[model samples]
Target: MKIFNAEKIKELDKLTIEKQQITSLDLMERAALQAFLWLVNHFQDKKTVYHIFCGDGNNGGDGLVIARLLKQNYFDVHVYIVPFNENFSIVFNSNLGRLKECNLEYEVISEATEFPNIGENHIIIDAIFGIGLTRELAGWIQKLIQKINYHQSFKVSIDVPSGLFLDKKTTIAIHSDVVLTFQFPKLAFYLPDNENFIAEIVLLPIDLDVKSIESIPSTYYYTDLNKIKKRYKPISKFSHKGTQGHALLIGGCFGKIGAMVLASQAALRSGCGLATVFVPKCGYEIMQTATPEAMVITDENYHKITNIEFNFQPKAIGIGMGIGQDDETTQAFHHFLKTIPFRW
Candidate 1:
């Protein structure tokens, strides 16, 4: 599925509104409804206490609606509005009044004086800052997220995590234990470095348009493994070892024969039909004892490589890990590189 940026998101939001013939409030309602539905499916109301923190944007509107719906369902819930600014958007104000009418446990923390103490056992619903957070959590709000992290409680971030940059705005993001994201996953949520930011997350579809969503452009993507699985081509049953390619690895100084062994091991594991390793004579016994599957050739010297007699055409050549920059070894490597020209 396609992920969007902050601008594209607004476009998609307006597109969804126009396409579905619903207002932005309707989108917020379904978003919160779906979030609450997920909560009901995963959690029971009999004894769970929920601490919901909301902002002044539509993200908080969703939180307020969740609070009201939970109350209507007779669940124990507390709503805390982390007041960044007093003037909330119209939908937020509307939901705020509705939550007030239900006499829900709601409080507005305008400053540090009104900050409420959250117990360690509580499930925190962080809506203080959602996907549109374009800047760093600055001043007192930065301190608030740090405090939230210190509590070490089971926290659930609504939409994207409270401080995530939705469309590559800022390079930073807040890590959430569980992110209940809407429609599609966030682009940052799938980054190799972002796994810590998002421990576990699930996409809650609220039905955005496919054509309009594709009309937008983005570089980052949420790599869905199931979708990738459909594109994987398995090995043909008639394939033979010779059909695979060979691999040549050059490395390993006097004492680091294990480097060449590891390279040969990886080459074999990656389905290389044949593998060869070139190292100093000091590593010959080591490689032979450790990995007998590899064919080995040694340079003339005992502890360093002066020259390498390259013969076989390998599909790939891997070099440099534990290879020391000795003069003779360096000369050999330079000669080898110039002898074998590669495109890229």
Candidate 2:
């Protein structure tokens, strides 16, 4: 799964609709259906009240469809549509027509003068804004989001948290406990700095065209089961000790031999056919005692490592494990880099 910027998402939407021949309406329906499927399967008991906050965009369209579906299931549902400009989205209007056909009650909050009283025990679905949102929240919508945050209800966002940037870090006033993003995981969701706003993220795959999506150039990636499983390979019976490559580890001083020990363990676990470790004279006993499997080489100095010498050919070199960065060590390391026919 490739991670994409906000601009690339628009290109993806265009590719899905234009090149792949998927209509915008179909995407909207499928998106709503997927969200509704989750709601039905997880919260079937109708144990909690549902309040959906919708803006005048496609995100709100999704909320309207969910509102209609939840009403059919006899779930206690309330929808608040924050109307923007003079006109609402066409798809949203279509969903509004359907919700009205079912005679479901919803409040059109056009202004902040009369705010809706929210209950803390209910679940709030934030559909006010999605990835298309660029600027900061303004006027009553900001207050509305603040009120939603203040309510302390379990909030779930569709696609993205309302007022959050899918790529860059935008200062958002609203936060969601869990954001159910569409398709790939957004970059902002993975950032440690964004953990509070995103909290926990769940990816909902909506079946975009594989070929066209691949053609779209993107460096960012969303690593998931599907992407990893597609390229996974299992070991074969014909494999042997020499089939895997040898790995060399350099770095261990008198007091910090444990660092090399941990690294060597990781190398062995990673299926290295052969492993070698270089340490100072005093740390040789420690490394040999801890890991008998590793071939050991002692440095020239007793208290610290000064030089690395080896005869056998190694496929990979793992360095800087416990290497000190003092002036002499730095010069030695620079010399080592120049001595080897390699780039550091």
Candidate 3:
């Protein structure tokens, strides 16, 4: 689940192609097939009209392959090629030729005016740009994306959304309903700055070389259920309450005793053998009433925490929940930190 940058993803693709001895076209076909399969699974109705917007790159090539597959399967598919410039990838041209061979007609959109009028019932597949997009889009292309966004159609972006940068924040990009990304999750998808443009991300694995993926260095990772399962350790049958870890939660003032109650309860639910809460004197009765399982200790002050005192060593300490930034509370917290023993 390592989240790699655009360059690292390209490197992984190159390594995968070299290790598997497959042509780039073969890889493109595999990626397109995965996307096609996803479409088939989600949109089973053959009457569903698909408006696939493709660029003059490999992402467009994937769109072309998907168009051909959908057409062959008797689906209502319409393909439109957005030629932003004269340059085009070889695989893209190859897929375009394959689409022509299937007698499936497609239109080339050169201007913003040439953009199609999409209905709300249609599914818009955006393959106009992928992870390779670095710079901001041109005015006309941005307008095209804006028009796509204006439609109330269910939009699914291929690979990454058009105009979205994997490594940096993007201002203008396709605001997709669902982004069907390949292999690893892009870093931009998880960032708060790009929250408006991103949507439900579905990872589609293309069988990239596993060793090559592991060899690449990445600082970010997307932890899934499989990863958690791998790291999960079952509890020993002979383990008792004392053998399990102890957790200490310290926070809460007069009116904010609920915070400590919830925290202590959460600690116990997380499988901690012992749950203890250190709060102001005013929170002692509330914590005991709300969370009967947790042991509570109260500071000398009633409205706020003036001191944090505990005898037994806790495996983990979680502090500062509802503790207001009062001068006395701040000084007490500082003194507590200074006096606390670090077992590790």
Candidate 4:
């Protein structure tokens, strides 16, 4: 999966509209239909009501389409238009006009209007804002977000939360139970700081142009099993122990020698021809018993590692696991780094 920013997503949508020779309204319908189908499959009972909170942007257009489809399917639905911006997108107005044909009613919420009363049985669909939002939310919009968070209803966000900044840190954002995103997963969705705002994510493809997506440059990427599998190489049947690479792991103190044992075992299991551990004298027996396959070299110090020296060359060396920051240990580590020819 490739992670894209808000601007790239907008560009993809434009390219999709141009290359597919379809109207933006049609694309909006496609996205909404996908979301609607997911909802139907997830909630088989169809007895619960969906209270959709929409903004006056393209995201709101998607919500309007969803609400119309749900109404046509005989499910109870309510649409609340959040009047935060005076200007509306062209597709938004088009969708709003189409709502009249479905015989479904919608309410326009303002600062003075009373918030809708929701219950535990109802679900809240948040389309208040999308990836395009770049500024801090204030005024009635902020208040509305607070009210929505206060409610006990299960919250679902479309694309992203109303106040979140897709490319940077956000001061306020909607805490959704699930996020239904289009095309690709946004970078912010994977960040730990925004985990509360974006709980679980479901990626839905809206049939964007593949050529355009491949051509677009991105700094972030999501790796799956298939991508990782492609990097594996076939080992030659005639290969011997000398042909494989060797790995050395340096770490462990008096009581933390288990860390070195674990690292050495992992290196050996990873197909390395040989694994070696450099630890204090106290860790000699522990490493040997834990990992009999790995070779060990003990330092002169009895309790902690005070020197790092090896005769044979290793393909890779991994350092700093359970190595305490004592004065002698720190000095020894610095001396080792200075003595070795540093290379990644």
> Which candidate number has the best TM-score?
3
Global Cα lDDT for candidate 2? 0.81
TM value for model 2: 0.84
Task: Order the candidates by lDDT, highest first.
Answer: 3, 4, 2, 1
User: Over the stretch 1-344, how does candidate 4's per-residue lDDT look in tens digits?
Assistant: 68888889999999999999999999999999989988888777768799999999999999999999999999999999996677998999999999988888999998898999888879899998988998777678888998998889889888887788888888777899888999888888878888778778887889999999999999899986788899877679998666788888998998999889888878877888888888889999998898988999988997887878788899889998777888888998999888787633
Ranking by TM-score: 3, 4, 2, 1
The per-residue C-alpha lDDT of model 1 at residue 232 equals 63
Model 2 per-residue lDDT tens digits across residues 157-243: 888888887656676546888787787778877787777687778778887777767898878876777667788766668987577
**Per-model CA lDDT versus the true structure:** 0.80, 0.81, 0.89, 0.88
Clashing pairs in 4: none
Query: Alpha-carbon error at 24 in model 3, in Å?
Result: 1.7
How far residue 67's Cα lies from its native spot in candidate 2, in Å, is 1.7
lDDT, candidate 3, at 339: 78
**TM-score, cand. 1:** 0.76
Better of 1 and 4 by lDDT: 4
The per-candidate count of clashes, in order, stands at 1, 2, 0, 0
Instruction: Give the per-residue lDDT digits (tens) of candidate 1, residues 1-344.
Output: 77776777778888999988998888899999999988777776557778898989988898999889888998889988877765898999999989879998677775454456767776788777776777666566766776677776788888887777754544344557788988877777766756656888978988887788887877766667898799766767887667777777888888887878888888888777788898888989888888888889888888877887776677888877467889988998898888787532
Candidate no. 4 TM-score: 0.84
- Give the TM-scores of the predictions, in the order they appear: 0.76, 0.84, 0.89, 0.84
Residue-wise C-alpha lDDT for candidate 3, range 1-344, written one tens digit per residue: 89998899899999999999999999999999999999999988989999999999888888999999999999988998888767889999999999999899988886635768778899999999988887778788888999898889999999888988887768888898888888989888988988878779999999999999888888988999999999987889998778889998999987898888888888898889998899999998898899988998989999999877888888999999898889999999998888785632
Model 4: lDDT equals: 0.88
In candidate 4, position 77 carries an lDDT of 93
